[model samples]
Target chain A: MDKKGNPQIDLSQSVDFLVFWGLKTDVKAFCNQNRREKTVQLCNLSRTEKTMIRVNNLIKNYKKVEALAGVDIHVKPGEIFAYLGPNGAGKTTTIRILTGLTQASSGSCCINGFNIEKEVRQAKQQYGLVPQAINLDQELTVQENLIIHGWLYRMKSSEISSRIDALLDYVELLEKKKSQVKTLSGGMKRRLMVARALLHGPKVLFLDEPTVGLDPAIRRKIWALIKKIQTGGTTIFLTTHYIEEAEFLADRVAFLDQGRVVALDSPERLMESLGAWAIDRLVEDGMETVYFKTRNDAERFNTLKSEQYTLRRVNLEDAFLDLTGKKVK
Target chain B: MIHGIIAIYFREMLILRRRLTRQIPSWSISPFLYLTAFSYAVGHGVEIEGHTYMEFLIPGLIAMSSMTQAFAIASEINIARFYWHIFEEFQASPISKVSYVGGEVLAGMTRAMLSILVIMALGFLFGVRLNYGLAFFIALLLNSFVFASLAVALAMVVKSHADQSMLNSFIITPMAFLGGTFFPIDRLPSWAGAFLNLLPLTHASKAIRAACLNQPVSIFSYVLLFAIGVLFFSVAVRCVEKAKD
Candidate 1:
């Protein structure tokens, strides 16, 4: 529909969009009618303003290997949600599912209300993923990375140019704009990965281990950029084994363990459930006492040690160990 | 499908552009040296089927170039996946398996065509004449595309990149050699002639050579090779799709 609400688009052109997205004729017609009704009611709103990514029980197998058993996750419009799991725990497999790179054994998934298998183009239009590996063309310069990525997404020339400039500046790579990817440092390449992923201004950005191998300072820098994007209302789905990365960046974190959602909540809430304290025994001269309490109570317990023996502080590290713990039983 | 093709094309071309400088000296130039050494040094000015050895060698060289690189596309991509950790990147991108096949086919064809052009130019420079004219170029292009499709498909379906290398060495080498590469196939054993007919390269090179040598072209077999190429290409696409699953 045009500005005057005259329903200016021809049915044929709309039909083509539906075909490109792989929607069946009936489903296409249904979506078209729904969109028409919604447009009349909410004419001034942006599309992709609702849920960005949704996955239900996605499973994948490789010969005898079941990489992803069954995974279910949903990401709302504008939050940086971290998908955390140990190595080989299906984090990459889930990202592969959401991105439509591989087929799921059985499941339903979508991005921004567009079913991924049926409407891949529309689903793709919702997000970009910056992989853990550098993945940039070592032969192409930084400029070419943005240009080709933009071209892949079918962005216009002017928009591509503007986005490249803005992205380079955003990632603080403005000076290395013409430099080849091989010439960039580890941190610079990682930053370029983010820039490439954002070329089309996707509503949701998925980062797979965004800071996996980077030094602490570089990791902090990438996390800071993720924060800025999440602030700007771009939903971010990131997978990282780095607990600190998830704890600092994710608004909500799902701790995936052995292909199950062992825990899912805000990092603070998950930590709080661990009670922020530990019980330990202090024995001297063949006598001992054990105590369990919060950090404040632990502080009072610490006073007992200062007056008599020894004391220790309860922090997030201990709390994380308590829940989804890794030590021997 | 078009977007997927475009994305795959970009991805493969970008990767090739980065890797070409390193790959060319080994893959493209080294093979040229082997041809020069074999046809010029060893043949020693002998007439092959009433033509100069070099003239006899050009078509085979062109076909060999296509055959070698076309199949190597799969091995190279698979190797990139495991050795370079690059597969994770493509896996995370929204580029589908179809796009992956599309891009690889485009890139492999481009590389195959580049090799064909280089070999042809060298044959021309060396004064090797087959008198087939522009028909030769068209045949060469078709051969290039067919071999490239087969190669990309081979790369996707094969379990191991190392096995791919073996296919190139064990499978590709003998076929290119015995399929009228250095001399005419008619002078060879009868079993070899029957065997060559079964190979895709034999048809691609035969159509190209027959047209270039100005013999009556086998229009049926030319179309047949093309149809077979399309089938192989589809097989390759299906393999890639299944690989994703």
Candidate 2:
């Protein structure tokens, strides 16, 4: 119970109602103050918007193997939450469940106040997914991909046309709109994917390894686009094995290992909790890492090391390795 | 739900339009060769069931073309599943299983219809003509529906394109030749005719030939075809549900 005579709500169970009411209130206030005509009300944006993505005790069993063993997650509205794990660590499985592409063996999840199991259509309408694979229609033009996605969401033809142009411009692929997706460079295809996912203006955008195969320069470009999308108030749920990706773009990162979350916190907080500096030393088995609270302490440890070593700032990868005793990538 | 079906069908139509140039020649050439070789070389001046052999073969060819074209959807569905992964896109969307299967079945029907038109043109060039009436078209529609639904079901189960081709060789090829498409099944041994009678294409050919030659068309064959189509459609929907999970 609270001061307003409202019962105390467990955030995990009532996240949907909170998001709906908060968003409803926000929408009403924005419409009143600005009186914008073109602004489409994707949801009742003014009532209550809080946690945009919530997963509770989600379990997925594949025959004899348990792919996801009772995973739990909560992403706040407009927050960039990164899910970090290695291959076959249930990252893609979790994304598949959230996007309605696969069923969980147990537990429940909700997206933007809509239960994934009971209210599939409503839940799907709340989020747009950029899959790990380049699943765009390769035979279709860049513009056609976006148009088809918009049509699937049941947007009007005129709205689809205008939104395609705007999204293409946003991703800097306006010049290549007429080109077939197969002809575009890898980076361009990735940009087009980001554009396609945003065409319907979904409240939550799931990016599953959005920059996995791209080079350093292109990965940075995608990171910038991700930040841009976040600034527009769309909650971004990103999954990646790239440790640097989480450190660079995530407002909070969850470290997952063997289908279970080992740690969850902001990248800085995670690293700070370990140490301020990290030293990597070459050993017979593999590289071993040691962390220190200060540069002076790292230097003192360096004096005691006989093998080759490199001193650097502590990163999310170190925090992950320390927690799980395994490499993220 | 309907909008999702429309979206899938519209994309297929676009792809078909783009590949029409390369596709039309192949679609026409096979039937043209069949007409020239089988009708001219074998038929000559023969008659069967009070009609010339060419008249008899034309309707059979229409039935066969419709069946093969409808079943051709299996290959396309395989490509979408394994190579392009378009099925994943549909699974991720708000589209229902019914809409996905319905849209794909309709696309198969469209392809079957186009192939029938091509076969008819070739039949005309070979100096063979028959009454193209509502009943004839209706029989063709039912036949295409049966095979298209079967294709949708088979595609979900087949593991690869090689498996699809194997099915084509073992099932479809044998049915096309032995199901009274090119020759009279009655002329064969009674045992062979009894076995071929179990095939859907055999009923399709018999019903279509009756409609084209203005004979007494059997309503039972139409009912049978409709029943088989509905059954296969339900099976396809079930397969899609399983595959999506």
Candidate 3:
């Protein structure tokens, strides 16, 4: 203990002391005011080592209907994690619980080590959510929307203004800053949502159906923008119905079905686990897919050899279908 | 928390500012029609409780206008919830429900205050100047508080914009006309007076009319309106919390 009866630690060993004693709060209080710089560095270092978004055994029920049974997810820092699920698969429910839009019936969600239910403000500050719907204020200008987002995050006006300028430019929406959101095109509105979400500089971004209903070109633009955002070291937790979008972007993907994660792996590994090639055969009821280790092996498969089949490379969707027995919608 | 409240209020004010050109005139027409029609056409040469009809009607208009304008916030909230989805954005933000309700209630009070000003201006044009003192403004503020809180509570309870309209038609419209806005409550039958007195607006109209006419205002009216405001405000916060759930 120090002269004030506070815990004393050598300055050089503060980080180690934190690890050894597991007394982050006490150390934070000790490092308050005088060792501010050290405190920030220590906290940031600790956060970097922790999972960016952690949800454990999350469940949700609407009356008798179980929306999410027992979902578990751990998103790593600076990686693009995709949540792929069919309709009614509880993908949105997981995102909702993590983002604090709704509560999980049971279990816990932590964003950058802050529990969403208990440490709401800190957890909320750690992440920005781009919801599936376009929730931007259509009556306001693009700059105004970003400004409001910043204000909601408790950012000062000067900081909000500077971030708005930088984010609008980053989103390629600088020219549309003065334009009302209602007048913007669909892609521009989507881009504005991205700018608004990034205004507070959150460590994690939750993107729910980020590229839905967009044309191929606009979708590619958003994908590139998402990639650029990830390169800036912001962890991305994405839920998308488009399976190829997951294949093209995700560092790792989780396939959810009936409120449970059926498969979780990197895209290449998930496809490789099934095989390198997939044969699409028209069955009596519907189409069926068969996986093979090689194109030659797929050619030699005796079951679909007599039937008409198209040889194609395996994709993430085929793997999802194989694992969940349900198409990723 | 204060910053979050300011941010939400700032957003509402921004939208209001953008629509002022349309809103100002829309807010003006009702008062203008009442002042012209009732003060001249209907109540000319009519004096109730030793005051000209115009003098008596001005404060009633103030109370009614403030109530209606404050309650108008429900429509804006409905639009945000139903069409803009801005409420979802707020839900995803770090703002507390108390701050959200506080901000919305403040916006509602502001709209009420503006409508009161318009009515005061209209009364000035019609040569119906009243006391316009501290008590008058306080009563107006309390009345606005009651209705604004009610608006926020009802806004959250209503499932759709159409239900909001139905609330206005069923609750606000009847209260505006029957809650001693255009006439004296005591002049009616005792049963009717007793029933109307049960409405919060009756006390608001009584307190405001007494203050504006420079008559002795009852402390009960002030106390009761304040109590009702607090009750409605609590309900609003609770409803917002439930809506978030």
Candidate 4:
């Protein structure tokens, strides 16, 4: 009633949807849902607040160059958000800040409703971190690795065993439990990292270049595995220079350039936003991508094409190149 | 912390078992060579400290070899970590700093103890008379533990494996020589012999040799050495965790 003859809403009144619904919901059902979410969230990093990981005016200097200039990002929960940038774009630096490995010179971050600086232990508990480095213990057996993970979270021995059995079954490593990690294949080790992250049933996971060194076939396997995990309910925060990777796995993609978030949106939304751009797609030895947005635009490009290639719609890679204005560095 | 240490200890021990067969010949054979050169060659003419020159040298060589091997294990493992990127996997785990340092120290201790055992076995073959008893085992274990902790601490401080090898010519080499590992401490200048007591290994070797030659126990020296070792153990863990950070 303050103006324009309309009812004035109280700006101070805010609803706690999570707590309200959580209490009203059946505890057993809620627990089961949480259990289901644990797998999905094992690779995700999100916050209860609107922003999952908030990095404010962050600065990180590595010798002569500043890795991260002042950066700001807003991510919501349950999104397969890919953080993309060229080499040295601070994508990993931003990720490191979110995950709490490298401390920010002057900034703050939060994860799953807790401040990352003040409540780091709690923040860590909420998200599993798969670092760029291979983090599995080589001497420990597969089962031993999982047990050690559970111990990190201080999980009860009985609880850890049950979860280990279930996780080993899920990861297709039930029989490899007794085998030492050093003897496992690279793909197997990658899968073990996933299993280790899931031991404590976290709500989010931070996957930092998950498939960096794998072959295409193994990459696809890992991708499919990530997809399978996501569909079960965990949100993911991924950082990679691979355009096609972001395209294939991410729900929403954010392009980071020069320590700034250049672009952020769903793959479809991004393609639609860049309305006038046309992509000429011809793989190195095959017809991989040949797509256009406008017929007039396609006509201009037709002068350069031959009949040996197929033409289709432009993809995430095109949107990425257009938005970031740089390819993988 | 204890759990992580034990986990690392047993895990390393498991790997050690795989490498032990090769290690035995490598470490044990050198002592026999030393025994013939010092025990038989020198012993035919010289006698000092109420025993043959060979007897005095045996205990010292045992201590020197064990200390050198202990430090080398620490340095080698860390250097190997950098080359293999094994530390990255360690960093990725949720294991605390205590466990990480514990693993290195435990591995070094294992090697040192193995060397002591090898030295003990070689004592008989080389005609070095050393009595075997429960006291000897305790002395050996404690001596190795002190050397291992010091070795790990040194390893954590050294920037590179190459640097560590260089330090053996300066830091560790002098320490071994001055630590009374190669000669009777009493035979040195009185002030220098007292200075030798400052090293944990010196007291360890003394306690070990005292038990060996049926000499009277030096309780003050034993407690002081254990105290020094405990201090280094704490400090070693600190240095390792700091480097990791």
- Sorted by DockQ (best first), the order is 3, 2, 1, 4
Chain A TM-score of prediction number 3: 0.84
List the TM values for chain B, per candidate: 0.85, 0.97, 0.98, 0.88
Over A1-329, each residue of candidate 4 has an lDDT whose tens digit, in order, gives 97688888643232223332333335545654564354224324434345555555677776567788776666666677899888888887877677666666555566766555555567777778776767666766888777766765657789989999998888888899999899998888888888888778876778889988988999898899888778877778888888788889998888788777777888788878655445445667744433456867776776676544434566666676676656664
The candidate that wins on DockQ is: 3
lDDT of 3 by residue, A224-302 (tens): 9999999999999999989889999999999999999988999999999889988899889988888889988988894
lDDT of 1 by residue, A1-329 (tens): 88887777577667755654454488666875674454323212223445566666667777668887777777778988888777877887788777877766566677777666666677787889887666776767899877877767778889989989998999999999989888999999998988888888898898989888789998899889999888888899999878778878988887776666666788788766655555455456543333355667766776666434433444334444455564211
**Over the stretch B76-142, how does candidate 2's per-residue lDDT look in tens digits?**
8899888888778788888887888888888889999998898888877777778888889999999
Model 3 lDDT vs. the true structure?
0.88
lDDT of 2 by residue, A95-188 (tens): 9999988978776677886777766888898999999888888888887888778878889999999999899999999999999889999999
Report the CAPRI category for model 3: acceptable
Q: Cα deviation of A66 in candidate 1 (Å)?
A: 5.6
Q: DockQ for each of the predicted structures, in order?
A: 0.23, 0.28, 0.33, 0.07
Model 2 scores a TM of 0.90
lDDT of each: 0.72, 0.86, 0.88, 0.70
Off by over 4 Å in 3: A1-49, A300-307
i-RMS for every candidate (Å) is: 5.3, 7.0, 7.6, 9.5
- In candidate 1, what are the lDDT values of residues B13-100, reduced to their tens digit? 7777777778666565755785679777987778855666676667777777777776667776776665655555554455666666
Q: Model 1, which residues run further than 4 Å from truth?
A: A1-49, A59-70, A276-296, A303-320, A327-329, B1-7, B10-45, B85-99
